[model samples]
Target: MASNNTPVSAQQPTMRRVLKMSEDEIKKQIRSTHNQTKQKLDFDPFYLFDVVKNILNPSIIVVDNIVQGKAKDMEKGNQGESSPKACFIPPCMLKRLSYEMACKVPGEEIAYETTISILRNVLSSYPWHVKAVLTLASFALDYGEFSHLADQIDSSDQLTKSLGILKQVPIVLGRQGVEKYKNSFGKLNTLIKLTLDVVECVVELEKRIDGNNTKDVPELSLAIENMSIDVFWTIITVVDCMSRICALINDKNNTQELLPFTGKITSILKSLTDQIAVCDRQIAEIKAYLKFKRDLESLQDIVEFFKKLIFVEESHNLQQATISNNELSKKTEGLRKKKVLLFFSDFDISEKVVSILKPICEEESRKDQYEIVWIPIVKNWTDIVQSKCKVNEKYFWYVVRQFSSVLGIKYVKEQWGFKDKPIVVVLSSEAKVEHKDAFHMIQTWGIEAYPFTFERERELRNREDWFGSTIDFIPDVLTWMKEEKYIFLYGGEETWIKKFEDEATKVTNDPDISSEEISIKLFNVGKTCKAKDYLGIFLKNLNKLFFSKSQKETELDTKTKEIQMLLSYMNDGEGWVVLCKGHKLVFSGNGTKVVMALKSINDGKQGLHKSTEIQVLLKQRYNEIILPVTCCKFTANTNSGWVHGDCAKCPECSQIMEMIINFKCCHKGHPTKAVP
Candidate 1:
């Protein structure tokens, strides 16, 4: 059966070729070779023409009928539906015709020209088929046999022409077709992947040419280089066209799910554009190296200025004498022709005050005739006694001298007679005060009041209500006490102290009152009382009295318990004991008197217990008690010393408590001494 089909298949191409010839030639060919055979077969000369006509132009109804028949067959057989077969000239015939057409044109240029022509027809005639055809072409350019054909042609010019054809695809498809393409699952994705594959092929070819070491093919190398650049740019253009189609879909459809993919494509485009820019910049730099050097030098100078502005040190250390007054004076001597502005404040208020003044100082410093100085005052011993001081002097100095001349901070307080902090003084170049109310001038006129002279001062002073107090004396004594943990009780009397103590004890002993609840209630009460001036002051005083009395009682009770426990086991001893009464300390040799003194101090300010006098007594007693203990003929135990644990017993009291020491007793029957 296969042998029987071979002769019939062999005759089909010959018959088609004869049919394609002119009528005269076709009849002549039939007469010359197949005359006897044709007579035996009874073949008509016009029969081939009929077949050719049918192949060239089939009926639309016949095509529709065939599609319907296939659909029915698909349903009956449960097989997948295929594309409707072409009723006109078949794809194989068209491909054969394309080859014949290429042979007619001269050179390899026909291959690229044919590709562009086919692309144009496909893009114009069939919008839906465009992506599929372009995708196939891209894949062919990547890995198919067409890649060799592409390589043979002058890629730079021919590929660019092919690219121009590809570019028209989106335009011909229009917005509606783009919308459909994007909505179709995996369509846009397939296109992007295919385009990227084409790009990769071009890049690989470029790499191969670059890696080739043979010196014989310089022209080929140069041509490949130009081709690669053109191909790269063409691919960029193709990518841009595809991206616009995707963007159109996104705009028309407004689909959120596609956003991630769209964003990725956008980022790829941006990265590609940036790479091109970098290449361009490198080329420009090569061409104009001296110009680039000059620009770079200017850029470096600008960068340095910014670095100094942003990263300059702003911290000032009070303990290390930030800047001496004499140094400030020396600095000012050079600025004698310039107007000076001095700002003074303690650390707390200085932060806010400087924020307002620093900008003005910076602006004024730009003028050659103006000089700005910051004077941070160390008002009290407590300020210095703190473990550390934070001074953002770098920020201040940067602002002061960023554009012009200015003196640094001068740590002077009493010498300048600054009673109130956050004061600003405007001075003449001769070290004479120009405007005493410099702060007020800044407040009223802002930065416009720079170089504040005596006239401006007089105008402000005259407008000021001298009799009316400009100062606001809102004393936040309670807030101060709370923050500082210092309870100051006014009118310290025995009755008042007892009354406060009773009230405090009553509140403390209340089992229902939690510590948190007590704090909240106290805060609310303070808030309410603060609204009333007289009541707030009275309440603050009362609170201090109550707290002091309660705290002292607590300390006295704890000390009494400890002393009683120690005294129980003691036979005889003369030793000084330190005791606390609120924040005050008391020292005495007589244990009984020490207990009495604590009560007296807690009772009221009776002038019976003086801190200085008690301190002196403590020194004398310490010398008498501790000096003897040090000289005593007792062998110190090296094996055991102080053990701060629950199991250890107190040596003096013989009570289960933390063991302080393990000293051998020289005097038998004497109680061992322990330091609390």
Candidate 2:
């Protein structure tokens, strides 16, 4: 007996050691023992509820603590610690946990009630935790569990309690709260879909009740009606808040400062809420009207029907008229201009008119002067027929109809006496007819003659003596070029030079001018050459010519000024029609002018000094011609081909050369062998 007691005393130390072990270690040991037994804990319907209540409840408490400002001390305590400050269960995690719990005990009322209670606690404490509440609600609704809860909420007392919780949600969460938890909620599609499902369900139930006897379970029907309205408004509020928040988030300038602009956002939300309230009132009125229609009182029902019919018709007509008026005002405002040139024509004539008018109309300087309104005289029968058939068309004649209606085409036609298909009616700034003969002007002088015609008409109206050809002579280019001594033809096209040379040869070979006295120099100004530099030189010489005249007391005549004006145009670098020592420009052409000028010089009608003019002409032409020749084609070689130039010397020899091509020769005043 003494030996057995000694062994029992030894077991006391082992038992004390087991008692000293931590609770976690003890639980691990029990779990290990339980696993070894190969036995399972029987499934309990309340197991999920227990799990949520134990595991998720603490997280909700922490969230509540944070929302209530009670966790600040804890946050400060763990600020510098290497360990994590506090347990942070994200709203998404909370949502997932709630969903799992709901899924586990799907059909259990106690499970659903527990979930709702937990979610309500979380929401009430931290009202911005909208995602968690929505998630729990979605789980219940999706699983058909909410319908069970709805059925159980039979008494008005139960319904009112439930409504109380729902009512607080919108008040506490508000628009800002919804915006705060939007990201945590992820896509709102699921929430919106759940809301729609609930609303649809309530609607279907109401329809079924209305289809059958409505008196039975009147409380349930009333409760469902209230639920539908509340749920519908909730959906609207959520969607509106989310949409506004998303818009703000998308704005680059507002994204970082969304919180700072809360006041503005709140104002916008208030406006939206007011609009929703209006919709709610409208819905209630519609529901009342529908109920009134179903009432058994036949006389009252008929009276109500007539009232609704009249109201609907009046609303529709008023809305349509308002829209039409707005559109008409916009069109009228857009078409209103200071001055307009309204042209009316058939399709073919309109196309022709547009082609002619496009150039003048597109000029930037003319934009502010007047507006062009083209109206096709042809009726758009195709568009009219299509419009009757409910098909859309944008035919040119449709625009004509619109304009004709807007501007009173009949009155305009009568006032302007425009009986012709193609006619132009110019309206003044006051929309009064200023010119009715615009079509004739366009036909006579083309679109370029517009505004000029208008100006001329103004002058006529004022009874001012027409400034007949502003400055006397338009200076016949032929007469001006003939007076010049030299003819310098500059052009990029070799064909131009060839034509001129052929014509010049004809002119030189005439009995009046000796072939020996003729001189022709060719310059190939290729595409790469700076033709502008030559233009600049011409401009500088013209400036000198103008200033030289100022030195003389006698003022230049109209012809001389016209000639100078013509010369000023040569700076365009199109082609030079230089004359009289290459200092003057008569005009630009494909050297046709030069050939004519040369012919005229030989004709001796202008009384030009032949010897002095020819000498100065040859000197200037040769000097100006050398620059392009040296830059483009000239190379130092005696075998270079000769060109036609009588009395021209070879650079290598003092002997008079003939057929000197680009001043190149055989070095002995003979043409190269390469020359034909």
TM-score for each candidate, following the candidate numbering: 0.20, 0.21
Which parts of model 1 have CA positions greater than 4 angstroms off? 1-146, 153-608, 613-676
Each prediction's Cα lDDT score? Answer: 0.34, 0.36
lDDT of 2 at 339: 53
> Going through the candidates in order, what is the number of backbone clashes in each?
3, 4
Number of the top TM-score candidate = 2
lDDT for each residue of candidate 2 in 585-609, tens digit (9 for 90 to 100): 3223223344445555554433233
Candidate 1 global lDDT:
0.34
Candidate 2: segments with Cα more than 4 A from true spot: 1-329, 335-337, 349-351, 364-369, 384-398, 402-421, 439-453, 457-676
Residue 22, candidate 2: C-alpha displacement in angstroms: 99
Q: How many Å off is the CA of 396 in candidate 2? A: 9.9
